[model samples]
Every structure is written in C-alpha cells, then in structure tokens.
Target chain A: MNADFLLKIDALSVSFGGVKALENYKLSLPPSRILGIIGPNGAGKTTLFNVLTGFIRPDSGHIHFNGQEITRWEPYQIARLGISRSFQNICLFGKLSVLDNVIVSCQIHERTSFLSALSKTRAYKKNEKALREKAWKLLCVFGLEKHADRRAMTLAYGDQRRLEIARALATAPKLLIIDEPAAGMNPNETQDLLDLILKLKEKFNLTIVLIEHNMNLVMQLCEYIQVLNYGRLAAEGLPLEIQQNQEVIDAYLGDTNNAGSN
Target chain B: MNKNKHALYLMISMGLFFCAVYLLDAYGNHYYQRVSNLMMIYVILTVSLNLSNGIVGISSLGQIGFMSIGAYVSAILTLPPGLKEHWLTGLPHWMSTIQSGLFPAMILAGILAAAIAFLVGIVILRLQGVFAAVTTLGFLIIVKVVAENWMTVTRGGRGISSLPTYTNLWWTSAVAVITVYVVLRIIRSPYGRSMLAVREHDLAAQSIGINAPRIRLLAFVISAFFTAVAGALWANLIGVVSPGSFYLWLTLLIIIMMVVGGMGSVTGSVFSAIGFTILLELLRGFENKIAVYGISSIIFAIVFMLVIIFHPDGVMGDREFSWDWFKRITPLF
Candidate 1:
C-alpha cells in the first residue's frame, strides 16, 4: 500500500491443475533496489517472476507499478510499461544476429511508423541509426561487440547469458527480472556477472528482482532477500538476517557448510 | 561510399533486367513471353508467402485463399459491363454495371484480400506452428467451398473466362520488382526485426516487448495483399478466373518454391520461384516428349526431398544475396 514503492504485489495467487504454484505472495519493492528471491527447487520463485512479467496470470492479485495497477496485463504491454525480463532458460532469438537481438528490443521504443520504415524516411533512417548505435553500445557493455554479427545460438553459453541480459536491458526498463543468470557459470564467470549486474543497476538506475540459487551472489548483491518455501514466503529481511533465520535455514538454506553448494 | 556503390550496382542490374524484358517483348515468341510472365507471377506469390511463412514463421497455408479473393474481385470489376450482364446474371445491378481499369481492379483486389486477412488473422494468429498452418489450410478450404457453392457471384466451378490480357511481361515484371523491393525493405526494417524475433522465440519476443500476435497479423495482412495482387496478375494473364486454379495444387507448388528457396529469405524466394518455374516447364517438355503423365511431379517431389534432406535450410539458408557474396563469386568467375 506504500505509494513510494516501485512494484507492489498483494495477495497474489496462481494454481495449475488444483496445485497451488504461488499462494498469497506479497512483496513491496522500492525504486533502484535489488531484491533476491531464494528457495529450493519448486519453491515458486520462477512462478513469481512469470506472474510479475504477465506471462502467467495470477488467480487473484493486484500488481501495482509506478502508481498504476498492471494486474493481468499482456507481457508485451507490461514490457512496454518498462518491465523487462530474461528467462531461466537462455531464450535469446537463436537465429538472429547478436546485434539484431538487441536491436529488436531497442525497436520497442522507436518512434518511426511502419510507413516511415517502408519509405525509408529521414526519421526512420535516424531512428535506425540510433537503434544500431544503442545496440552496439549494449553489446560492448557485455563484451559482446566482437560477436555482433554472429548468430545468438552460436555464442558461448556464458556469452549467451550476458547477451540475454543485454537484450533485456535494451528495453530501457525500470524493472528487470532475471531468472538464475548465474546458474551455469563457472566461479569466474559468476563473479564477472555479479559485477556486471551491479554496474548495470547503477548505470540504468534499475529496480531488479532476481531468482538465484547461487548463495554467494544472493549474499553479496541483494539489499533485501525473501525466502520462499512451498509457494509461501518463509522469511523476508536483510541478507544477513536471512542467513541467520532458523526457519529459512531449515526450509531452503540448510546447514551453513552445505549452503554454498546448494 | 558503400551506399553509393550499392545503389549504382542496383541501378545497373535493374537497367539490365528492363532491357532484357523489352527485348523479349519486342522479339520473343508468344510462348516465350507468356512463360516469362508466369515466372514473374510465381515470384510474387512465393515472395509474399515467404513474408508470413518464412520470415514471421507463421506457416500459413491460406495464401491461395487471398489470391482467389483477388482473382474473383479483379475479374468481376475488370470484366466489361456487357460481359458482366451476359454472364453474371445473379450479380447486383451496381456490380453488373460497374467497370474498372486493370490497375484499379488489381489494387482493389489487394485491399480486399488484406481486409480478409486482417479478420482471419485475428482468429488464427493465436495458433502456433503446425496448428496455425492447419487452421490456415482450413481457411483455404472454406474459401474454395464458398467460391464453389456461391454460384450467384462466382459462377461456381464453370468459372469466368475471356478476361483482359493486361498481364503482359512488362506489367508482371514491374509488379514482381515492386514486391521484391517492398518485402526486402520490410525484412530489413525494425518491424521486420521484430517479426524475426517473434519467429525465433514467441515467449522471448513478448518478454522483450514484441507483440508476437500483432506482428504475425501484420505480416499476414501484407502477405495477403501481395498474394492477391499476384492472383490478379494470374487471372489477367490466363484470361480466366476459376476457383479450381487457386486450390491445393497451386498452394503446394508455392510452398515448395518457398521451401526450396529457403524460408525467411526474400532473395531465396525470388530465385527459387524463377528456378522452379523454369525447371517445371522443362520437366513438362520432357514429359511431353516421353508421353508420360505425372512424371514431372515425381521428379519435382524427388528434388524437393533431396533439398530438404541435404541442405535442410534450403538453398539460401536464410542468407540474402548480398553484394559481398556477389563480390566473392565474381572473383572466381
């Protein structure tokens, strides 16, 4: 109910075939803050991301963003309203060039009409130039400029992950939801990704919600952490408090020795 | 400097193409000219179909439905008032008396097809992959049934004949050039990039703010417009309009051209259409010489299978004919 929050989800619920995926999930995210949602497998973390991005409609809920209710909005509409997301599975446009993948996201903000594009008018040319430049700069940010013309599917797994984030950022979103960006990365890549995410947050002034099983990443990055167990919020607090919470430890974190491995 | 070079090359190639067309029109035999005209019509059909099925990855099989709509509309409008009264007695008074030149009739045909596509797209664009393809095939069947049973307007299976011979080599080639230019322009634009995104991954596309359904619908409508224009060209060239002509055979043939050219490639469609048209004609000649019926179709089927098995992505594999490619090949020559 706080008007100052950037994203507010209240009493959100979703079910599939009589099995509740998310029940009464509530979260209030303020502007430019990083919130990490951690849980064991089937903890409804991705379900929450899906619901927030409008890929999955909640059974009963209200999601307010920037003082506007956006419950059950279409994914593209939500995206156009400055909510962008990257998938848990690297869902880059496989056949398109790496630059084109970013350019496609950049196009959502273009002012050129279809007619202008067809006619190749001055506005369209200028807009296209701007989009290419922006896409190239984004690629450079992720160290992907050298592979701009390569097909997205041809990139290395780590690079594909970076490109997915770059493509999501190209949308100029106020809120970015990334699902397990560090899932398949080695320690070095994970560290690089951690730094990149932090830099992107400051550079883009973005409010981020990430679902991560990487405990190190969660501990190091997130300002606020929420633990979900069995489609319910088990704990919510600062990272240090989350680590110490006995219930969270029992439900998801487990013993401190095995926590990082988990 | 690169842009200017590309433009100069384009102008030279176009000049060469037009000169060839002019020479053929002036001196080529009637049969040769007609065959060339047929190639252009097929080029239009394949390119338009490619916009939806190849680039947008909708895999629609209803392109011929739009073509039939165009053919019937253009045929009716361009038919002389006297012929309309004599043949289409069930027509309304306004329709029977109305007259339109070939250009206006073709334009109207394209518009009508696009309108129909807009409505049909709303319902079927929600379907994906094979489901969408099957639904569009059903749309084609529905159009055919209506064209067959609605004897009042279409004159049923007997068809309307003796239309104007307006689709000369010049007209067909000009329209084909325009179709290629417009389609390629679309494929290169931001909108086209969105279409490609939608084709590559529907959910991923939507997450990045590309409305997959809307993009599919736009591609469908534009494709329908061009397909209808091609149908108009065909009706005029053949001097007949028939529901039978816009059926499964033509649909399969056009799809084959698109597949052989490489889906998601405009230049591929153009080359494949032209290549297939000539190849089919030569096959027909071979069939006639051997007095063997259905042999051409068998050969074509084998060729199609080979292309699918070996190349898999078709001859062009989604790569357009670029100046770089031209430069590379020219050195070998």
Candidate 2:
C-alpha cells in the first residue's frame, strides 16, 4: 500500500499464451501529474491499462492504488476503488441519452439499487436529482450540456469523444486512463480536446494516463512519457529528452510505413 | 393526450377491458371462454420473453425449456385421481397438496421454474449467440426426453390427461396482467438499465462499474420464472400434456411472436402475442395448409429475418412507450 503514490505498478508482466504482451513493467506517480505512454500499434499500451484496471489480470504483478494491493481486482473493483478508464474505442452506452450515460457512470455514488428505483423511495429521488445535476454540470464543462437529451450514439464524432471524457469524469476518479482522446479528431477539434483535458484535470485534481499517437499532444501535454517499441519500454523521460533519445527516434519514428503506429 | 397520459389511459382501459372480458366469459359459451384462457397464457409467455430479448437483448429461443419445467411440475402436482391412476403414478406427497386448487399450483409451478432458470442461468448464461441457443435447446430436448421415458409419472408418449380445467379466464387473465406489469417494472429499474447497458456494451457497463454478468443472469432467470408459470396455465387450459407439448417448434413460435411484435417492446410483445394466438386459434379449424401462415411459427421467422436485416434496433429500439411523454405532447381531442 502506497497511498502517497496515486498510482503504482510493480513488476508487471502479462502473457497471452506464448506471446508477451507486457513484461516486467513498473511505474509510480502521485496526483496532479500527466503520464503519456507512446508506442507502436502492438506496443502493449492497452494491455497495461487492462492489467491496472483488472480487465485482464497479469500472470505476475502487483497493482497498488492509494495504498491498496489490487493485483487481481476486477474492472468494477478498480473502479470502485476510484480508478476509472475509457476504452481505446469510445465505449459509451450507445442506446442511452448522453445525460443518462453520464448518470449511469455515476452509479458509484448512487445510493439506490434497482429495487428502490421501482418504488421511487426518498433516497432514490434525492440522490437521482443530485446525480443528474452533477452529470449536467459535467456535460456543461465539455460544452455538451445542450446535447444531453440526444442519444449518445447520435453524437457527431467530436462530441462523442468529448462525451466519453465527460462520462469518465463523472466517476470522480482519483486516477483516469484515457486510451486515445485525440484519435479521429480534426486538428482544431484536437486542440479543443487538449484545452478541455487541461481544464478538467485541474478542476478534478486527477492524475491522468494517456495512450496517444499524436506527438504534438503528447509532447505539449504530458509531464513525463513512457515509450514502447514492442511491449517493452523503449525509453522513459521528459518529452524533450524522448524527442531527442536516439533509440526512441530510430524505433518509433523510424518506420514511415507504420506512421502513427501508436 | 400525451404519451404518458395515453399510456396511463391505455393501461387503465386495458384493465377495465380485460376485467369485462373475464366477466363476460363467466356468462359466455364454454368455447369462447376457453379461447380467451389460451390468449391470456400467450400474453404471459410473450411479455416475459420481451424482458430478455427486448430490454436486455439476449435474443433467446430456449424459453420453452422453462415452460416445460412449469408444465410438468404443475401437471404432476395437480393430477386428479383418475388421471393420476391412468398415468401409473404414485404421486409425490407435495403433489397431493396442490391438487387442492388452481392458484397454489400455478404459483408453485412458477417458483419451481424460476428456481431451475436461476440455477441454469448461473451455468449457461456466460455463453452468448449460438452457444447459448444450443445449450438451452439441448436443455429443452432433455426435458422432453425425460417426460417421455418417465412414463410412471408423465405417462410417456401417451402424455398426462384429464387435467382439471380450473385455469379459466378469471385467474389466467389475472396472471396475464400481473406478469406484464412485473416485466415492465423490471425493465425500468436500475437492474433493468444495467442489463440494457450490458446489451448495448458489456465493457462499457463494467467500465462504468456496473456488474455486467450478474445483471444478465438476473434478467435471464426472472424471464424464465414467469414464462414457466404461463406454461402451467397452458397445460391446464389445453387439458392435455404430452412429450410433444414443448417442442422446438413451440420455442421458435414464441420467439417469432416476440420478434414480430418487436423485441424489447412491452406493447409490441403483448399485441403480437394476442394477435398471433387468436389468429392461430381460428386457423386450427381450417386444416393443415393454412395453419403455418396463421401460426407465429412462420410469421416470426419472416419478421425475425427482417428485424435483423432492417430494424436491428427492434420495434421499440430502447424507447419505452412513455405515458408521461404522451401527457406532455398530446393534443386534446
């Protein structure tokens, strides 16, 4: 248990049968920091997130968050422990309204269960009002308050991406992992996304881990960076040092054919 | 009126209408009354299946297994003395008690069926698509086979007969109304929303801290339980039970009614089930050829194909028919 460290992965290794997905990986960070992970398409970035969040338990590793050993925790368990994640593909509930989607994500704070919702108990009504207000404010922060009543699946690509962030933030997570917030965005939208990320990170006091291929966003936004070539760390340091690191340059930026590999 | 007010009025109207039908049956010819009893049972079957396929999106065709469990449990328990002797059975002591009347037997049958479904859900629910369909289909076959070979209790291929025709319109219609309300209530709860979330996206639901597997299991079991009680009512209404009672054809037909009506739509399921059942009940007098067209067995297949092809969001597409919306939006006539 290392409560002082907002997140820590100790000696993590994941293997899918014989193929190694991630190996002997380790990192530790406190709150109010952004860690960017960049690697090729198969560099095990998503696998790392899965391991930390218990979507896939590593064959060997210990994941500690806010002072609890959480190696084999389920995805829901990690979430309840205040760690939240967004998938590489914006995994919002497509059939629900955007506002409803955010409210569902905030179930961590909802006191009522399915039984109580049927009866419309006082706790259910009171808590639901507060949760809806919270979800509305989150959508407002992301400039999505106007679209709250629309189906989440009907959102245009940019709003969908922004709504994913809003939904993730609704969890009130201590640590948030976003697979790729800037993917599929136009340059202008990407900049808007970056600005929104900075605002929300400060507003929520969150430690963020981002997996992104956009060099500009990574270089400008992350305080620390971890680079991977093929499931193993290629380099780890400041953004300037990473841009100049000979190994990172030759490995990640080397292949023009696999451009945007991460 | 608005959608909510419309729905509220419709619900109130439906209650009054069904009650009037029950009262009319009390004074009507025996044959018309019997047909109404059959329609009420179909209402339960279709409405309960809607909870799974419509709201939760499991897309099942194995509900006959649950119904079969209900049928055999209720029939065995409620077998009158002559029928019991003819079936070559020394009744289980518990069966002796339910032979007393209709409500107890149906209630017990529903509970028994739900318990089986709850247990089976724990085992086979992790499977989706064809694997789940196969598992449940196999379950149905096993139940039928047991009914055949266990002649001492089930009367084998000859089936159980002389079942007391106690499940008249009064009680059957009551079950119909209650089951539809129960399933409707289920889909509107947090549990219902979580099941819908899982259907929409399993990883997303879990990512949001909803327990996906558990929610699926709950919906699956509850649907099974209610469907089973409907089966018990059917067994009594028809006054005959056989190995042929719960064939795959029936399962396919149930699925068809659900699909044509619109999977995941309460109003759709109920309307389709009643229309399909009444149409078939009429067609049974027309001999063999037209029966296929009249029965949902054929209609469901076509509707299912089209639903999957064009209307994959289903008839309702996650939208509850909101009486509240009706109240807000409707123009006063």
Candidate 3:
C-alpha cells in the first residue's frame, strides 16, 4: 500500500464468457506523471480501461483511486471523481456544436439543478456564463475557438481528436485516461500531439494514462511504460528500459507481422 | 442581454398566439372548433413523445399505454357518483361513492401516469435501441389488455360512456400552451442538453459524467406527465373512454405526426400536429359521402409515404422558430 500513489490496482482479472480479456493486471501510478500502456491488438489494454472506468466489471480485482475504493462505481461516478477518458473511436456528440460538447463535459463538476436551469435564475445564468467562458478557454487552447459553433461531426479528423481531449479536460479530471489519441494521425500530427500532451500535463499538473499505438509519440511523451501481450504484462519500466526489453520486442514483432500480413 | 430579449419575444408571441386561437374558437363553427381541440391534444402528445423518442433517442411506442392510464384514471375519478354506481357495478363501494372534480382528477391522472412510466422506464430503459422499443410495445399491449378485460373499474371491453364533457377549445389549448412552455424550458436547460447527448451516443454521454439511463428516465417520466394530460383531455372531448380508442392506431398517428414534423424539432411537432389534424378531418368528410370507408386511413398512409420519401427530416430539421427571425422587423425603438 503506497500512501502517495494516486491509483493502485492489484490482481485485476476479467473474462467474457470463456475467454480472458485481462488477467492479473497490476498497476501503481503516482500523481503528476504520464504513464503509457502499449500492447498489440486484443492484448486487453482497452479491457483494463473499461474496467477502470466502470464500463465493465472485473471478474476479480481491487482498484483504489485517490484513497478510495472505486472498483464498482458507475461510469458517471468515476468521471465525477475526476477520472475522465476519451474513446478509441471518436465519440463526440455529432449533432451538438463543438463548444456545446465541452460545455456538457464541464457540467460534470459544475452542475446547476434542473429547477434552477428551468427558472433561468440569475445565479444559474451566472454559473452558466462562467462555464461557457471556461469551455471557450479550453477550445482556445486547442485552437478550436473559430469552429466553436460548427457541428462537431463536421470537424476534420485531427481536430475532432483534439476536441475530444479538450472535452475530457473540461471535466477537471485528476486522472485523464485517453485511448489511442494518435491512432490515425500523420507523423507531423503525431509530433504535434506529443507536444500538446506534454503541454497539457504541465499546464494542469495532470496525471495522464494513455494507450497509444504510435511508438514515436509514446516514446516522446511517456516517462514510464507498461507493455502487454495476450492479456499478460510483458514489460514494465522506464521508456528506455522497455525499448530494450527482449519480450517487448518479440511481442511487438509478432503482432506487427500478423497485422501486416492481414 | 440577448437572452432577456429572446425571452421577451417568446412571451409576446405566445400571448398573441393564444389570443388568436381563443378568438377563432369563439367565432368558428362546431367542426372548426372540434378540429382545433384535436390538434391541441395531438400537439401535447407529439411534443411529449418527442422528448423520449427524439431527444432521448429511445424509440418507445408505449406512449399509448401511459395515455390509456391517464384516460381511465381521470374518467373514473371525475364520473358522477350516481352514474358510477350504475355504470361500474363491479367497482368497490368506496370508489363508487367518490366523485372528484375534473381539475383534480386530471392532475391525479398525470401523476399516476408519471409514476407508472417512472417504474417501467427504470426496467425497460436498460434495454438498448430497438429492443427497448419492443419491450415498451409489449407494455402498450398489456395496458390495452388490462383495459379491455378489467371489468371491475373499466367496465370491460364495452368501455364507459355518457361521461361529462369537460374539454373544450379553451381548456385544451391552454394545456397545449403550458405543455409547449414547459418543454421549451426543459430543452433550454442543462438537463435537456444531457438528454440530447444521451440520444447522440449513450456511451459517450456516460463517459462525460452524464447518467444515460437517469437522463432517459427523466425525459420518459416528464413525457408521460404531458402525455397523460393529453389523454385526459381526449377522454373528455370524445365523451367516452375505451381500450379501442388507444390502440396501435393511435400510436401510429402520434408517430406520424412526429416524423412528418421533423422528429427532433419542437416547432416541427407543433405545426405537423396542426397539419395532420386538418388533413385527417378533410379525409373523414370523404368517408361520410363516398362509398369508400377508411378513407382517412388511406390519406394518412399516402401522406406518411410521401413524407418519408420526399421530406424525411420533416418541415424542420432540428431548427426552431427563433426571435432572431423577428429582429430584422423591429422598429428600432
């Protein structure tokens, strides 16, 4: 039991029917750190995220976050507890404007009652105005202010990805977990994303846990790395140490060959 | 500043609109007044349905179930105690002796319907997409069966007749305005935004700390409230209450009004409710003179098919009639 650690998980296991999605996963993360989780496809990276975010219950596990047990909380509860995530596939509210997406996210912690909103009271309007300004500030950081009124679905793919991160940040999360933020970007875009991730970490003093397939971005952005293969941990160390680990290399090579062949 | 101005404009327009409708009711013929009443009731129904079907993204056909609950409950409560004894012999003695006024009965009807909808929504809202719709459809069937077979309170399949006519153009339209006002308030509120997010993608909504099922339930319960009120109005208007009046046909009529009015647009729902009511009345006239029966159904079918083909998004695609449309005409005061 590390008193200073912000998130601690032990013996986490989950199975869907007969197949094991995650087995005996363990993690200890400190505050104000960037930890990267890398794995081949079907290696249970997303499954772990699902369990942590309360989308899926683990068959057996214990998860403690910010000195409280949160293993069985609902997704919305997890989010309100300052744990926010973005999806692997973009999940922006397609019909709402980009600004509205962030505004909705901002409501997680800063909520006005339904009655007050219905009344449109002075207090409610003031709170709403402050939140709207905060949302605009987030958009401005991501260079999305110009397109704040445009429908989220109409944004370019890279911008949509950026908007997702901005929306997540609007939750005022202590632990921000982003899944595959650089999945479809070009090299230049990936480089830009790496810079943005670092900048956000400094700006917000955030603890980030990201799963990425882009090796360059992962190597540049992560201080610590954990590798998984076939639902088992292959390596865990600093980024340089994981790069030199034989098991990690073999796992990546094997999966790359399979993916390339297909 | 703009928000206050928008609110003022809305208030003025709504006041004028109601005044015009009241005058028309006073001057119009019996046929015209009847059509207008039906239109207002449908407006209430479609707007409430829009909250669940369009805003919350739940395809529920169980609205007719809630409507039936409202109709029977209100009708039973408001019936004269003397008539209750003769019409519903199977009812308990205490129930037969209680005769409530129309206003309180309608309020209770709305509350009862909302309670049932809340309980049912908690269970069936967990089902995703079409499965949820199917479960709610089953709910509608069960309500119909209960209304038909439960002779104790409902008088079985024959239904209750000779009820007092408490509904008129003024009352119906007043309720309609209230419904619209409440719905607009909800749509502009934070809760409404959360409901819309749930409609877009439930998973994303949950991730953003919006409880998808809870939001859906809120919309469902509120929708049931207004839907029940509409049913109470309808029961009084026709001077009868029957299981047959609130069957799949009524559900289909409400859905058509929603689809043809642009599923997600409140303004579209209001206008489409008016448009279809007039169209159906015209077709009913044909059924009386011509040898053909079910002419109204045929016309409705044609209109639905045409709307689906040509204007699938309805007359308004998630757009509202806003005060901005009036800003240009201001006298620069």
Candidate 4:
C-alpha cells in the first residue's frame, strides 16, 4: 500500500505530573478529508491537538506531516510548514480591526523585509496592497467585509468565531485544525458554520481535523472518526462504525445517558 | 489620496520644520536653543522606549544602562588625546592615543548597544511580565555598578568631562526626525505586526507562525540602537559624560514622559517630550526666582498623580495622529 497519508503519528505519549494526559496515541490521516476527534472532557482530545500543533511536547512520539518529521518542530515552524489551528476559545486579535486581524495572518506569506518597509520600496507597497486585497477577499468570503473597520472584540460572538476561522485560513494552510468552533454558537449559527467549513475545505483544497462535541454535526460531516476515552483511543472507524462500537457506547454515551436518566 | 500629493504634503511639512530649525540656529537665545535640544533628545529617548513598552508590550526599565554605554563609548571615542591624557590617566597606551570624530563615535556607540541588547535579550526575552521587568532592572543596576567600579575604563564615579560639545540643533533635530521615521516604518512592517500579534497573544501568534521571542529580540535591539544614539548626542551636547547622570532619576523621567504622552502613540511621545521639556524649563525658572530647589519634583509628582486619576490611558491612548485629521478639515471660502 502506498504511504499516502498527509499526517502520521506513531506512539505519541505525554504526561503532566505523573498523570498521563495521552499515552501511545497513533493516527494516520489522508489529505483533504474531514476527520473528527470526539471524546468526553479530559479525555485528551485537545491534548493530542496541542501536541500535533507543537504547543505540547510529547514524552515520546514521531509525527510526520507532508512526509517530513515534525515532532520536534516549534509551533511557528509547524505553522509555517502549512498547519494552522483555531483555539477552542475564540482568540481573535481583539484590539485590532477585523481587517487587520486577517492582514497580520496573511503577512506570513509576505516577502518584503524590514529594510524594504523602511524604504517604502515599490515592492513593499505592491506586496502590502496585494495583502490588503487578499484580506478583503477573505472577509467577503466570510460575510465580514461590513465589519472590516470594527474591532474584533466588538464583534458578535458568532462573528468572532467566524473571524477566527478567517484568520486561520489567511495563513493559506494545507491542513486546518478547528477546536470546538461551534461551542458557543447557536443552532442556526452552527448550521451556517457547518456549511462554511465544508465550503472552505472544497474552496481551499484543505484537509481538516475537527474536534467537536456537537455529535450530529460531527456525524454528518466526518467520513472518519476517532473516539478517545481517558487518554486512550476507545474506538476508531467510519462514523457509523464508531457510532455503533460497544466500547464507545459504554464509556461516553453510556455515561451521558445514565446522567440524563438520573 | 494619490502618492504624489502625499509626498508633496510630507515635503512641505519637512521644509517648514527645517526652516524653523535654521531660524532657531541663527538667532534663538541660548536658553531656547538648549530647551529645543533637550526636547529633541527626549523625543528620541521616549519614542525608542515606547517600541518595547508600548508596541511590544514589555515594560523595560533598563534603557539607562544602554544610554550610559552609548554616552561613555562615544565620549571616550571622541575625547581629544590631550583631555584623555589629563583625565583618565590610567588608560592603556593605545586607548590614550585613539580619537575619532563625533559622527563615527555615535554610530559605533549605537552598534555596541545594539550588540549588547541582542545578547541580553536572548536570555531575558524568554521571561514574561514583571519577572522580565525585574531582570531588566537588575541589568540596569549591574551596568551602573560596573560603571562606578570599573575605574580603569570609566574613570570610576568621577566621570569623563569637558568632551567635545558638537551636538548642535541640526544634528539633534535631524536624528529625532530620522528616529521617528524609522520607528513608524517598523510599526507598519510585517515584523512589527508580528511583534504586535505577540503582544496581543504570544501563543496565538506562535500558532500562526510568528516567532514571539525573535520578534521581541528584534524590537529590543532596534530600540537600543536609537536610545544609544540619543544618549551619544546628549553626551556631546552637554560636553559631559557622567555615571551619575544616567541613573534611576533619568529613567523615571523618561518613563513618566512615555506614560503622560500615551505609552503607545508616537505623536503622543513627541508631544509629551516637547511639553515636558518646556514645563521643566519654566518650573526651573520659577524655582530660581523663589529659591525653591525641589519645586519641579513636586510639580512632576502632582502631574503624574492627576494624569493617573483622570486619564490613565494618557493623551492619545494608542492612536496615531495622521494627516487625515488635516484632510478632514475643509477651508471656508
């Protein structure tokens, strides 16, 4: 079989003060697919994302992205290498204008240096103009062009979440990881976000790793699903297969159902 | 809106400023000339410090250390061989003979400060918040102690005096304008945006491919360069270089100027520098009349207290003063 996966993780483990947050985790992800990671709180789903994105260093592991070993790369290096992520909580540049939030992210691709900027060289002006155009186009895509001059913190909560996604996409990533994007969103907003996520993947040719608690949305969008429980993989399979898996039913849904009945 | 109109406006303003400086140089009284020089020096110092304290969001109190380094280096470099022979008698043979012009010495001083800042930032930029600030404060103390005790190099606390006083109004104003232009360019650059992003949220910035530590280090080094240049110019203007001059009192004055001017606004920094210089000069004149020695300190304390109570964000509050303000006003026919 061809090693066609865009990302492959092997034997990843991490511990905090003798409490293993993640242990012996493994994954193989192909490109341009929506992969969902689901589990109860403290089940290490976000921990895995953190390690994958370089916020946390695992005790032991190897992660290969785009066929390059990336386990030891810094967060910024990993981001530059084509991985971008949105936080579980909205983390927009709150004091900046909505347009500037996207412009700063788009700056990762800018070629001009400090000297060029200081000189106000033709190249710097052209690059800055192009970047602004690109950022405006991105705002148009997310229906945020009207709010371009407003501060990010002044945006509505749903708009803030969408803005975070827009900022992430401005990096022009090959892989986009979104953590709890729909958490504070209403059902109507979540529905729109679901459509937006699917549209972005298609439009940008992006592979997506989504961590969400909204089961219906997850089941509808993800072709593959991995369920973690207490720092271990409880089940990994097709969405339907994971839905019917006995262990997942026992560890996650079973607890929820028991609490509901109580 | 067009580039040519903008350039023309800039040229007109710059031309006006140059005319004013030439007039001052030609006919202004000694007191007024001295006041303007102090204003320009303060503008350079405060604006550079604001790059770290305001843009990069690091409250660094070690600026005096870099300033002392620049002042001493430039003074030693530019001091006449006869003067060096008269004072600082323990100096090495080559050092006693070596002398350079003020311009090269100023540049060398800035380069040395930048080099030292780069090395120091590598270790301390990793620290966050007050921990980093305290470490910098410690750095200031260490530099001061070294300047005091290193008798061979600094002439101990006796300090170097009667150096060439070559810093005229033209030099100070030109350097101040250049400093402002360079800082504004930096703020509008991508690296500057990266530094601002790091200031906003370091983790978020890093996750987006902005290296926070490197951005901070760059800002620190750039700030050190400008600050050192200001100090070199100051040393030349006063014809004196003393360890006692660049102390906590000078640091406090600069920091207060930054705060009162609006910590993050370049225009505010310039305004505050000019305003405070004039205010201090007036207060000094008043003190001389009344035989009151510490009235200026009292006034400074009162001003700080009132600003904190009424307008803690300072005058401009992170906003730039732009040509748009002028463009918005139409002349009544």
Clashing pairs in 3: none
Candidate order by decreasing TM-score: 1, 4, 3, 2
Against the hidden reference, what TM-scores do the models get? 0.98, 0.91, 0.95, 0.96
- lDDT by residue (tens digit), candidate 3, A125-164: 8988888999999999999999999999999999999999
List of chain A TM-scores, every candidate: 0.96, 0.94, 0.95, 0.96
Per-residue alpha-carbon lDDT of candidate 4 for residues B1-333, written as tens digits (9 for 90 to 100): 566766887899899999999999899998888889989999999999999888888769998889989999898888899888777677788988988887898899999999999999999899989988899998899888988888867788888888888998999999999999999888888877877788888888988888888999999999999899988999999988778899899899889889988877888898888888888988888999999899988997899889878989888877887666666695420
| Model 4 stretches astray by more than 4 angstroms | A255-259, B2-6, B89-92, B326-333
Best prediction by lDDT: 1
lDDT per residue for candidate 3 within B82-175, as digits (tens), equals 9899888887899899987667878999999999999999999999788998999999999999999988789889888877888888888889
- DockQ for all models: 0.89, 0.62, 0.79, 0.80
User: Under CAPRI classification, how is model 3 graded?
Assistant: medium
lDDT of 2 by residue, B100-152 (tens): 46677788888987888878777777888788878877788888898889877
lDDT of 1 by residue, B111-213 (tens): 9999999999999999988899899999999999988888878889989898887888898999999999999999999889989999999999999888889
- Which ranges of candidate 3 are over 4 A from the true structure? A253-262, B1-9, B287-291, B325-333
TM-score of chain B only, all predictions? 0.97, 0.86, 0.93, 0.95
The prediction achieving the highest TM-score against the true structure is 1
Listed per candidate, the RMSD to the true structure in angstroms reads: 1.8, 3.6, 2.6, 1.9
Ranking by DockQ: 1, 4, 3, 2
Q: Tell me the interface RMSD of model 4, in angstroms.
A: 0.8
